[model samples]
Target: MNHIPSLNDIKEVHERIKPFIHHTPVLSSASINELAGCEIYFKCENFQKIGAFKARGGMNAVLSLSKEEQEKGITTHSSGNHAQAIALAAKTVGTKAYIVMPSNAPIIKKNGVKALNGEIIECEPTLEARESTVQQVIDRTGATFIHPFNNYDVIAGQATATLELIEEVPNLQVVMAPVGGGGLLSGTALATHYLLPEAEIISGEPEGAADAILSFKSGKIEKAPYIKTIADGLMTNLGDKTLEIIRMYVKDIILVSDEEIIAAMRLIWERLKIVIEPSCAVPFAALLKQKERFAGKKVGIILTGGNVDLGKLPF
Candidate 1:
């Protein structure tokens, strides 16, 4: 099992990555407020560099390496955003990056990796295959492997977004984020529990990739035999460290269906004039689908990323 990042670790990550990351703006909507009966604040991480919040963690992990380790380069397996984040971060730090991605990864993400001058290794869409391919690249190039959401440094880095959000919206009563490998949720839980102890830290999971939901309910880790969702970003299973943090600090994990995700995506696009991927829309889907439960509260939802293939818009 991997080491879990604590609040102090997150604070260090924030300090290290602060100069490299954007404290993305938070947007509010009276329209959404009326619907959910809550004052809704959306942290627009979609506006972040690399079109996602992954850049913070990517930069932190890459920059933290020793000069010799950095000279060997960095490697990771990602569907899209994380690959681009690592690629761009490596470029910023004067190093190289090798990304392992599934053959079925979105073209926008694949191209983004290439655009950043990162080498790409295409593999089958299974977890085992992704890991094996990443290891092969690491062994061949001697590149440092940066696990997408499992590493303590990576999770701590991802938590910085929540830290900024809470600081900006001090009155927030509840916070929600999309969960996949649970890195962001774990980091967010740690930060929110420390800063806003009264805040309810909730996780939004795609019904297609609701392993976290099942894990929370079963009081143990669980896996979906196969991921089936348009929300490609949320298809990953929870990591051991992430599950431990979620069990300790997360208030609940809510599941949203593909249809609900689509509806929320469309709604955000039409109303907020913001483009969010299916994974980023899951939290909104939960707010809309579970209105009775989330109503009459001050909710902060992290809009995790916006790297969508415009040509593949399901709407």
Candidate 2:
């Protein structure tokens, strides 16, 4: 697997997706700064197209394809954001998208996919079931697979967010993002290491889905037996390439509980006026829960996505 993505690769992706995607703003709060005791600069990826950072990777992957490949279309399995990103990107490129999603996926995300005119294949929630269903779709349609997190182009595209973040805030001392399959974390680590060499790259994971944390500690890829948390987007085993990047650049992994995540969500909603999902709240939760470690430091946090269903607020 290709684990390394050079600065040039990230630079190319920055150019490819710039016209289509927003350079989502970075936000800060003196109030939240008072609570967390750190100078936090939040990269508002939650405000991005498709309401997630996945748009960068998805758009880059779709746009990189040749005209012939576009004619054949694309396929992938995702819980939400990736599906919407690919669906929207394919539509922009005048191509078709076949997305396999778990039956349990949020209704808002499924609707977002349909809104982009992407065909949906509903399957059971297990990884095996999702992969099997996607395989059948691929075998029948011959659409190129756009992996959610594991592909080289996908990782490179995701890295562009950190590229912009670091460029905008060059003095950042520490950078952090929530890790699921490690796509965002991998890309962030690669870009930060290359662009801001002295910055510490960290990842926040839900206590229920802390595979990346365990993997970092044990020096091996790990997976939780079952994930039980409101942060649906952060529930997955770390991919092989992602693990390699984590080993190379990520300084540490921190765990946040569901309660802490809810508190963080409320803090963002009340203070930042951002409607981020539980997955996006993990990093803030880590900072709030572990205040001593980050006190007075210049911290960068990726508010990864804001695709939560308004009606389903767990408050």
- The prediction achieving the highest lDDT against the true structure is 2
Q: Write the per-residue lDDT of candidate 2 for residues 159-256, one digit (tens) a residue.
A: 99999999898799999999999999999999999988998997888989878888887878887756899999988788888888889899988888
The TM-score of candidate 2 is: 0.96
Where model 2 places Cα greater than 4 Å from the true spot, the runs are 1-3
For all candidates in order, the CA lDDT equals 0.86, 0.90
Per-residue lDDT value at 65 in model 1 = 91
Kindly list the per-residue Cα lDDT of model 1 for residues 120-184, writing each as its tens digit. 99999998999999889888989999988878788888889988998888878889998998888
Q: What RMSD does each model have against the real structure?
A: 1.8, 1.5
Question: Could you tell me the C-alpha RMSD of candidate 1 in Å?
Answer: 1.8
Residue 45 deviation, candidate 1, in Å?
Answer: 0.6
Query: What TM-score goes with each of the models?
Result: 0.94, 0.96
After the best TM-score superposition of candidate 1, give how far the Cα of residue 126 lies from its true spot, in angstroms: 3.6
Q: Which pairs of residues collide in candidate 2?
A: none
Name the weakest run of 10 consecutive residues (lDDT summed) in model 2.
1-10
